[model samples]
Target: MGDFLDKRAEHLSTGMKQKTNIARAVVHQPDVVVLDEPTTGLDIMTKQNIIEFIRDLKADNTPVVFSTHHLDEVALLCDSVCLIDRGTSRFCGSIEAFKEVGQSGELNDAFMNIVKQGTMHV
Candidate 1:
């Protein structure tokens, strides 16, 4: 994007537009940052870059709130999670605690169990 700094967003590709939006969001260094599906359609390297960027934010003590359907992303990036089912929050807690409740000690299994029970614990 070094050469794209002068370009208008309307002329940008979808991926570039996504990056631009993210840049806009954090330019002011807000207390909390919220992103929805930040890496859904990005290329592999871009996705990894975004993950590392989030990690940098975490290191800087920035509280990031991102919504992603990718469980693998959650496992990699989240310290705590809020599991929502049918527009309702079923669980919210630390990742370790969440995994401990599962039979196999796997996050996906615990998530499934929570979804199955529809248990409400916010």
Candidate 2:
């Protein structure tokens, strides 16, 4: 967001580019926010900033649907969760119910157990 702001899009770093993209996308405050791996390659600070933005959107009651490999983000941000396995909805419900699925009360473990049960649908 420094000198890069004065430069062309091609000159920005991956994180900076993603940040700008998100900012531009949400400037109008759309009805819903959908992001794909939003913070995957961002720096810690940039990632944190984006996470806060997501939180702010939620606080304002804007529905946020983002795909992330970071389970911690899911734990911190989502009230309900959906797990897609091979283009199928393997699970979709409250976070607590999802936790119970794994029987260990852990996000990562829950995800694994869900995926491990390839034929199960909930």
Clashes of each: 0, 0
TM value for model 2: 0.89
lDDT tens digits, residue span 1-122, model 2: 56676798887878877887788778888999888888977999888988898999999999999988899999989999999988989898899999888666899998999889775556
Sliding window of 10 residues with minimal summed lDDT for model 2: 113-122
> Model 1 Cα displacement at 99 (Å)?
1.5
Q: Each candidate's lDDT (Cα)? A: 0.87, 0.87
C-alpha RMSD values across all candidates = 1.7, 1.7
Per-residue CA lDDT of candidate 1, range 37-71, in tens?
88877889999999999999999999999998888
lDDT of 1 at 68: 89
lDDT of 2 at 88: 88
The candidate 1 region of ten consecutive residues with least summed lDDT is 97-106
